[model samples]
Target: MIKLRPQPLRGRPTVSVVVPCYNYGRFLPDCVSGVLGQEEVEVDVVIVDDASPDGSSVVARRLAAADQRVRLIAHETNRGHIATYNEGLAVAEGEFVVLLSADDLLSPGSLARSVALLQAHPEVGMVYGFSPTFADRPPTPRTTARSWSIWPGLEWIEQMCRRMSNPVSTPEVVMRGSLMREFVGYDKRLPHAADLLLWLRAATRGPIGRINGADQAFYRKHGANMHVEMFAGVYTDIAERRRTFDILFDEDSACFPDGHQLREVALRSLAREALVTMCQAEKLGQVGDEPHDKLVALAAEMCPPERDPRLWRAYERTQTRSRSGRGPVVPRTVGRAMADLGGRIRWRRWRRTGLMSAVGSL
Candidate 1:
């Protein structure tokens, strides 16, 4: 473990942006420029090069030398991302802190808006805005509002639990530096969902603030992205999610105050995630017997005995769909037409009933 000493601030920056780079030397210029260009907020940038094989250290050193607000932390040995993040956190002295990936870019004026929200609401432990993801090309930037919504922390957690997946992108969210310092840094055990767990922990401390607008940050969805690797089966998504919820339950039991209620919510969330995972695997034609059997066993153990029938039924449906394939074996042209029609129907239903919000309520 690396020991972090607090550094003396020169003029007190309102926000500290930590850009952790690992072999992303090409994107360093854009990432650093984005942080420096934010309007109306005093910001400091710490770029940590985790011993990248690429020339990331060279780029980081250049930025640090050119600007007093920008500092570079170059590790001799390549430490993992979590270690790099903690090192940056230890050095960060701003009231609001963001752990941004070097491959990602913050939208124009995002810092100013997020800072305003946090300044206005002392009850909010974290604030996040809309993060549009792109693959080949970045999206057009939009002007964000100075306005935001404050939702109860528990409410946000419940909504997140119902979704069974992370909605907040990593770069777009900012944490209260004081709250961050109070807790241990991100959980090393949760390699895939550490950010999610951190977000949940922050929510437990205070209400969550959301800046309701587009263009807070640009999440570059390239082949080397961490989530891309996780979904591609580089890590076991099921096991990671289980560990995430376990950590959440253990850490936030005081906030929950009801052990049985927390356990039930965790179980339901796991079961929902398992079903979703099966459906995704079926769509990809990657559902092998061994993994499928393991998923079934995991679901059975997590779910209550009384609720096992419904869970098993859902699991069986996924299995049948995987075996039979999705829809009929029609011609390519007909298949496209059917898919378009189904998408339209789903969209109409979503618009009429607000499917996502309704599900969250449940």
Candidate 2:
């Protein structure tokens, strides 16, 4: 049981969940249900509808009426998701906070597990666990947490810098309310990767925790998903990621002695990603001359020809193959085979641990 802090209205820790809705009225009920159904935690649901044209306000209002724990914030004008998220966060009055999308679902007992970690370890600012994605229906999630992994905040941030990707899928994250309030709101400058930035900022404040061998949330994948609609290509995604790293280091360089080195690490990783994408595009014949040119430009801009001669040479080889109009074929080089194996290993680790394991091992 979560030892209720200070104000224990019902002798339980209250978890305030913020659900942002936009044209997802059809999914609002299921999402709210998952949060309200979490065991052993008192939940307060705040639904912020961003002037969704799909009758989302009506759904939200109905939900609020049906359950006293649910509150509806209907925007008359269409504020973007960032503004909506901030407005909800500002009013959270609970021991813990969660920002869940209207299209996602929280796994059973997830809040309890998260609360337990926060109560036991006052130093852990945030905890997250596996969040599997589904299309039509949510899969049955793991209800029991078999183990926990905790990392020093700085170490986790460095691991994130090396990966150059967002590990936490929004709904799976549970943050201490006091720590979350200190940060205020998500950065408007990073609309595509605000969540990634938020996680990094949280790590700066205290230790990070991860629950293993269990699911924490379910992400719904569909045509209207923001990530799919906004980030249509690998190039845009990589650009935004690089921008995220730049902002992180620019703002908090004082916190890290190796900030410059970590930035370089991130840039090199991004460069390799761009080059790999170029190779994949050449093999599949999916990229046009213009897109291929953009990928090469990104690789050069990130890693430069002089900094990573091997990556540039590989880029040149890929360009030659693209010019020759080759179809998809098996990767023949040992380097390519090793890269594929490493990617698979990382994916499996993420599936089990909700994070990349063995930081600095690569």
Error of 1 at 262 (Å): 2.8
In terms of lDDT, the best-performing candidate is 2
Clashing pairs in 1: none
Q: List the residue pairs that clash in candidate 2.
A: none
Please list the C-alpha lDDT of all candidates, in the order they appear: 0.72, 0.81
lDDT for each residue of candidate 2 in 1-362, tens digit (9 for 90 to 100): 12222211234789999999999999999999989998789999999999999999999999999999999999999989999999999999999999999999999888888888777788989988889889998887777777777888998888887766578888889999998798887989988888888899888888898877778999888757531242247777788888888998999788778888988988998888777755654453345543666866887898998998877776677667656765334544643455457667877878775566432211
Candidate 1: worst 10 consecutive residues by lDDT?
Answer: 353-362
Return the lDDT, model 1, position 8. 22
C-alpha RMSD for every candidate: 7.1, 5.0
Candidate 2 lDDT trough over 10 residues, lowest sum:
1-10
How many angstroms is residue 272 displaced in model 2 relative to the true structure, after the best TM-score fit?
1.2
lDDT of 1 by residue, 136-177 (tens): 667897764634667788877776666555667789888889
Off by over 4 Å in 1: 1-13, 224-231, 283-290, 317-362
